[model samples]
Target: MAYYPAEVKEAARGLYCKRYSIREISRTLGIPRRTVYHWVDAEAWGDMLSHEGVEDAAQRRLVLLITRDDKTKADLQEIDRLTSALERFQRLREREQAMRGEPCETASAKPEQQDQRGTREKRERKGGDSRSGKRRGRVIKNDVSHLTPEDFKAQLHQHYFAYQRELMQAKHYRNRQILKSRQIGATWYFAQEAFEDACTTGDDQIFLSATRAQAEVFRDYIIQIAQQKFDLELKGNPITLHTAHGPATLRFLSNNSKSAQGYHGHVYIDEFFWIRGFKELHKVATGMAAHKKWRRTLFSTPSAVTHPGYGLWNGDWYNARNKVKRQQFPGFKEMQSGILCPDNTWRKIITLEDAMAGGCDLFDLNDLKLEYGPEEFENLFMCGFVDDTNAVFLLPQLQACGADPAEWADYNPKLPRPFGNKPVWCGYDPSRSRDDASFVVIAPPEKPGGMFRVLERFKWVNKSYLWQVARIREITQRYNVQFMGIDTTGPGIGVYENVRIFYSRATSIHYSVQTKTELVLKGRELVESNRIQWDAADKEVGLAFMMIRQTTTPSGAMTYAANRSESTGHADAAFAILHGVSYEPLARPRGGCRVVIG
Candidate 1:
């Protein structure tokens, strides 16, 4: 532990006993604030210490004199004789005052005694702090005095306090995991914990962050806290404090397995799940801390199950639970049981729900729900884990209504036989840049309210707006297209205008939050209800559908688009189909007659 020099320590004690603040003592001592804190033991050097010590010493001396000194015993006998003589002398003085018409001292003291009793009874009736129901237990209050300055700051946040209490209360765990909702202040809380440990302990501690910017942020916070709260300035490079006990240093580094090499200290891994090569980093960190009293904490808001942190949290428990459930029941949904921490490790999961319930005001749940939509908000803010290996459209769901690519390729769009005399609708999404412009033609059902099927699909790269419009015009004329839904967002506006001039049946859809949302909703509804079918062997089409992913913004806005893979394109094809579904296909084949049942 870092400590102050003898002179500085003396100065700190003097100022502290004089009721000077810790910051004031630190400034006077010209030492690091934390060092001053370590040197000034409040319990040992409180407000009444000197007076109580002097009184105790006098009493002890009196006892020793009575027990071991005959001379002192004789002196005490004389003192008692003098005390009785003084009492008689005082009584004689009072009798003389009464003869002179002066009031007796006893009469003056009676009401004072009555007043003291009345005050005591009144206090008892008031019940002190119990009436307010805010009385804290002595033990709990005592623990606060043990906290370092930075920890005291952390206590101001209730969630952090509760988290620390849980960790401290656990008997068997040295390692801890904090899976928390985003923006819930876990980073700040742990940073304070690390700062306190570095300031108060002789141990060398390492703080790792996901990026250089983040590492600097964590480091800057420590320096700021030291300066603002303790009047300590951490100057010079490689930030080290030379103290009476030893040299204490806090080094911040970027998150990497290599950074952990040849370092021995408590390890703080911030945003552990977001770090690349986290598994390797974890291995290296644990190995470095294996021989020492070094402790490690891995914490993050969850992402995909592919993240190494998720595996650490769920893998063991999932396997064990899976085995037991399979034995009990032949079939069961695969549900992750709970986090199974490693030996001497603790795991805690705190969601936005928990934080809000605990009266945390950092996040508005309704806003986040709208921004992230259900799936993303649930994963990031709800402390819910997701497996995104099959992102968006699952292969099985897509394959249910999928047809063979060979059959789809054999049926030419020029022939009228394949369309089955049904009115065909085309959905168009145009892109002027590197993204491919895609269009899909759908064949409506032969009967009323029947499923729609993909008749033909095509994507054009480096195609001119005029060329795309010509193709739309040609398709409209060849297939006698009933209705065309075209995305009028960005470059699509020009295409929508030109196509409308040639093909009057085309509808321009101005893409906005509501429109895209409705498009995705309608697309999903069509798929789920088995109202739409596509060719299975069309890899580009499948990839486009798979790329459709939704994202939420911090301001509580949502957007949906393809995941954008180099192998395929931005989900223009998927959006086109989504647009096609908006027209609803009229739900009747051409030349079909409706009966008047009523």
Candidate 2:
């Protein structure tokens, strides 16, 4: 089930208040019927992807500390001790104040308590951080006192702290996948490291996009911190962050076009899988490449499937700090063998095969599902893609369909009668690329009583649609004059139009045309799933019906695939007529045929 975004909840709630019908509510929400009900009640309201609720604001910050490896056990213990001591010391001081008659004491003592609780280690270790000779990856690590913004405050047996300077200048990147556990402010710190690119000695461009609206909020937090702590201002108005240089906007963009264009900077796309389409993302990446000195960063919230941005961002600056800390890395099989990866340094946490492996006694699907959502979950998790796994026209069925007739002494594509050499039923598939195709054919059996043996199964290829048409016409006559169905989704329409004009000049066969996409919808309506069956003597009729259905099968399949929740019918009328003939005898004999009501 698709979850409703929180911002749309009020609009969703207004449905009952406005007393709109479910259909009207859906129209208002611009969603499907199921989504209308999904947002109808408060429980459904909670289903909205929201982070708001009752929690101590500081408790929220507490998560920041526990998640990263900046703080140590000793530091936490000392903070606790100082806090308790400071609390008691304040009580005694307040007692002394009572003797002198002041207002009841407040947590005013918290300042000194906080001083001891928060900064006691800072003071104790102030000079200690300057101590030298702590050699780390290509750089000497300093104590907490000598930490750089890029570095986490160091915690031995934990994460490396305060190493930003060393990270940027690291000689080589270790190629590995990194998986951060929960409670590691890895996200904030990850963005912080990227933000450091913005604030460091040399300026750099950055782009950050989120899967959903709230994910965009994380970028705002990073920007706010950059402004207050690091002297970076989010630029642009109607404003997002603007760069000090030419036209690089450091703005939070939703996964849509809002975030994809007009930037020449290192991209930091967060929660990449949450966003559905990447057409815009590709456009932005290509635009960024045009800038020459660009870099890219990707942040993900570990959705059910990893997105394109994650694989691509590995090329440029990724978390060198994570590598320094020995965090696990991740990879992608979906990215076409890492073709999208950044050239400089690459990392991945898991492969598709390992992602589906059973690690413990109880196998968990989180490995597969967590990396991707349903739309991508199949490829990311299942690691296989096919047109239809359980298609009725299975390979075996298709093999049977393509099988040569036993009665034929020799195989031939030559037409036998009315459609002689011209063509009859054209099966057009526009292009079986992501877009559906228009399958078409001209003629099958020469006469009305004959079967439609396979003609050209016209697959569409653009620009050279003529190549296909030329191929079809090469065998079939140029001027026999029969009806044709051209897929027309891609070049077929233009081909059909242009061919009609050319043939009017070049040939005598007056070809009538049916635009397959338009006609197929009508065809599906006629079939209505009543079941098509015929007898031994009705072989010609049965083959004609099946041929008609095959010509229109793609449309029916697409419609049913989209509306799998509902039952639909089939297409019969589309194939009922044999061929549109140019010349016929004055009185054609009517075949023994009846439209059965049952």
Candidate 3:
């Protein structure tokens, strides 16, 4: 409807409010004076035009205050008087224009030379400096400063992956978690925004990185942005800068978050996923910010699914992302708004696939695939929560070999053990204190190397060594176990000697790094080949499978063990099963049948 665009019209009104002549507006806009005058008279521009006089008054008063050589209480009061008169003048000017048929009916038209003279007067009053061969009246004006917020934001995301821009512009910035691909510019974007905010506001920005080196890098970047855009040089022990509003500080700290208390400001935790003692550090850092209602943005690449960060990312926030109604955990409960606004913590996940599809060329997918294996790359850049770094078995492979619920129900420990002529093998893992001793009974396939179907399982805690031996004896006699493998570590040695005193078929398995590796490899072979099926519905057994982790030594030797969490104690149940399957029976004497160890 209007001749010029909305922003141009707003800028025109703003300049007019600053007391720019119609001719000046025309030349600036590259439009004719008649067109400018015509729009300034339109009903649509009436509200803006009336407010222009008020804005002009305020700007004049503020400029005068800034230019004064020595400002006093009386001067400040006069500035306030000018501010209060702004609204009254706007109304009076509007009414006078209505009666006179033109805005500024009594004002004289001035020459272009007068505008230049007025600017020089203000510069002189403000004690302008000429050391750089330019008047000090105007501050730094970069091309980027002219861009609108939306324009600058869009340009910032040109190199971003598909979902990255969406994530950056998300309404939620206060409490946010971003699990992203490596080198995706997420940290860079946040640092830029934080520094910009600090330059314009007096708020302090606190950044806690995984290491001192990382914090130093972020500090350098923020300082660089400030210097480039504002021509401000910020340097010191703590990285301090003086902004137009006041003194703002950007403090960078490493992973020693325990000493990060007593600061009320914007908090950013970088590389959170890999931070040592992150669970404790997160509590300390976030807890300090929580009371002050400070903004918090946590950034990191995905780590093990067992990580606490993973639980936070996948728990309540994950549910919200899927648009599902679910119960929330502590600190994750819905805000009173429940409208998914910026005040709420926003969770964002962006993987390499999303980046590649979004036109990011920083990384070649083929090259990454070769450098890091598919699983490793997926975990690192694809935002996958899989424990590819240390997992003995992938969750997917384990799922593929999962037994149906009905099959598992049939083998319930509460039900009587099934009778069969099939050769039964037992793996025993023994622990005396602070751990549970467990055993898994498995039936070999009808033919060799076919598959092992786990039929029964047993676990006990706080039992005497003799009691465990009695339990083993009962199992061997009842199931007619062909070959039994038992752990011979610590108390296990006594148990093994007692078992062999009665049962010749039993074999003692010494605990060692090599022996453990052999058993874990055998289990891995079964899982990879889909040659093992176990009850997926059994939570205890399933948890054991999940806890299995493979650690690689610097010497290239690999070791297998469970990541015993407080919730899931030692993975004796898992080792018990592996030991059972490790048993191999010797051929019976030609005329004799397979001997049962009783």
Candidate whose lDDT is highest: 3
Candidate 1 lDDT, 175-270, residue by residue in tens = 767777877666666666666665455456677765544666667776676666554556532355432123456667665455458877777777
For model 2, the stretches where C-alpha displacement exceeds 4 angstroms are: 1-189, 201-205, 208-217, 220-249, 258-260, 271-277, 298-347, 351-598
Could you tell me which residue pairs clash in candidate 3? 426-580, 427-580
What are the clash counts of all predictions, listed in order? 0, 71, 2
lDDT (0-100) at residue 95 of candidate 3?
Answer: 87
**Ranking 1 against 2 by lDDT, winner:** 1
Q: For candidate 2, give the lDDT.
A: 0.36
Instruction: Provide the overall lDDT of each model, using Cα atoms, as 2-decimal numbers.
Output: 0.58, 0.36, 0.61
Q: Give per-model TM-scores.
A: 0.41, 0.28, 0.40
By TM-score, the candidates rank as: 1, 3, 2
Clashes of 1: 0
Query: Model 2, 247-269: lDDT tens per residue?
Result: 12344444445434555555555
